[model samples]
Target: MNFDLNTEQKMLKDSARNFFSREADKEFIREMENDEKGYSQKMWKKMARLGWMGLLVPEKYNGEEMGFLDMTVLLEEMGYACLPGPFFSTAVLSVITLLESANEKQKKRLLPKIADGSQIITLGWIEESGTYSGKGISAKAELKDDNYIISGTKLFVPDANTADKIIVAARTDNSPEDPDEGISLFVVDLKGDLKGDLKGDTNNKSINIEALKTIRSDKLCEVTFKNTIVPKDNMLGEPGKGWETLNKVLLKAAVAKCAEMSGGAKRVLEMVVEYAKMRHQFGRPIGSFQAIQTGAAC
Candidate 1:
């Protein structure tokens, strides 16, 4: 078997590389690190115009109807450029979850907005336990008359501060026999009366989001939900059986993240080789040294 990118994949990789090189240079990336939203709306719009936001969405939903491998090519380029934004959260994580679990009506209602870049969604999974297992999900979602009241906190949620909606994993039933059972996924509407710095006030008290400074300076937040109200129709997948869908989301996310890291590694290697060629020591370029060459070869 041959391991080669198809013609379309090659074109996608090249276009993404060029776009990042021209638009999201080192300086721009640094600026976004300090920005409140941690990304550029201008660049987001441009990517939307490029149909990147809809890469995995179905054509009927105004998407490109691309496959996972195609998405991997694009993500690799993004990682090489160290692109900072909600693209991973919105495009990959949320999109896959919706596709794998959402009902037809839910997809029709939300997928179009996501494809057009008008909507940004993130997953609210990791909690205080900081584990990615069923036991890690301690948040509770109680069903009301026509709504589900979600009360819990999510840690390390990417781009929650800027997302229009969040797919929250909550425990709808407490089954001591099996921790994974009775877990449900709810698409919580976060859009509300805008206050400041992307903060909004929902009907039942505003969802508190505190930005956490990470080593990569990526936009990660600790989101606190104090009686968040979600419509019953907003639930994704079958009730008490959301773990299967969430598991699929996590698997895809892992593969996408590996692709991103590969790109970053490639860029680092290039930078190191360039530096070795430029910096000379003992009247000879470092790259000319056998030791340097051997290390680079690996």
Candidate 2:
């Protein structure tokens, strides 16, 4: 195997590193965590202009169509910067799901907005079960005429408070023997049936988005939907096979996270090495000390 980044990929990595280092400093990251939306739309807009948001989408849909390896390069930078907000939810999870399962008509209707960063979408799969498997999915959905009424609680959802749309997993049919059966993916527009607006700031009447505080500070959310209606046209993939579809998406997600973690760990290692070599202790650089040298080596 070559085990090396191509020229374009290396350029992308350097560009991303420079951009994030300048724009995503510690102050920006801290400020974002407290922001109601968990990220700056202004920043997202800037990224859209840079075409980072559309790096993997098909060019026909206003995207670069670069593929996953390229997207992973960008994701590595994102994690290294500790960039906050719906980028992962909208760009990675939701977009990949759409590409994998959504029909042409649906992709045409949806991909452009995401590619241009005009819309933010998220996935809802985890529930009280707390597992990312079919056994964890207990949310229910019922097909009525041309629509589906979905009701369920999703826990540890990503950036739900700020998303314009949420792609949910619901149970269409119950089968004790087949836990994966009856699961379906539905796109729920947050603008639907809300008393005020989609922002949830106008004294939110029906929308339920709660932040789940954790040491990680990754803008984790819990979303509850009661009798929420979704159009049949919003279905992402075949009904009753959603668990299988989502499992695949989760695998992709895991790979993306690993890529990001690798990047972040690399940065941490660099910083530690620099500190060890620079910091002086007992009349010598800490890096010269056997203990510090051993720690850095390990």
Estimate candidate 2's alpha-carbon lDDT, on a 0 to 1 scale: 0.83
Residue 160 of model 1 has an lDDT of 92
Which pairs, if any, clash in model 2? none
lDDT of 1 at 249: 90
Writing each residue's lDDT as its tens digit, candidate 1 over 70-164 gives 99999999999999999999999999999999999889877887899888999999999998888899899999998888899999999998998
Native RMSD of candidate 1 (Å): 3.0
TM-score for all models, in order of appearance: 0.95, 0.93
Candidate lDDT (C-alpha), each: 0.90, 0.83
Angstrom error of the Cα, residue 120, model 1: value is 0.9
Worst 10 residues of 2 by lDDT: 195-204
For 190-293, candidate 2 gives per-residue lDDT tens digits of: 75544332222222233488888878677789999887766677787888888888888999999999888888887898999999888888898888988877
Q: By lDDT, who's the top model here?
A: 1
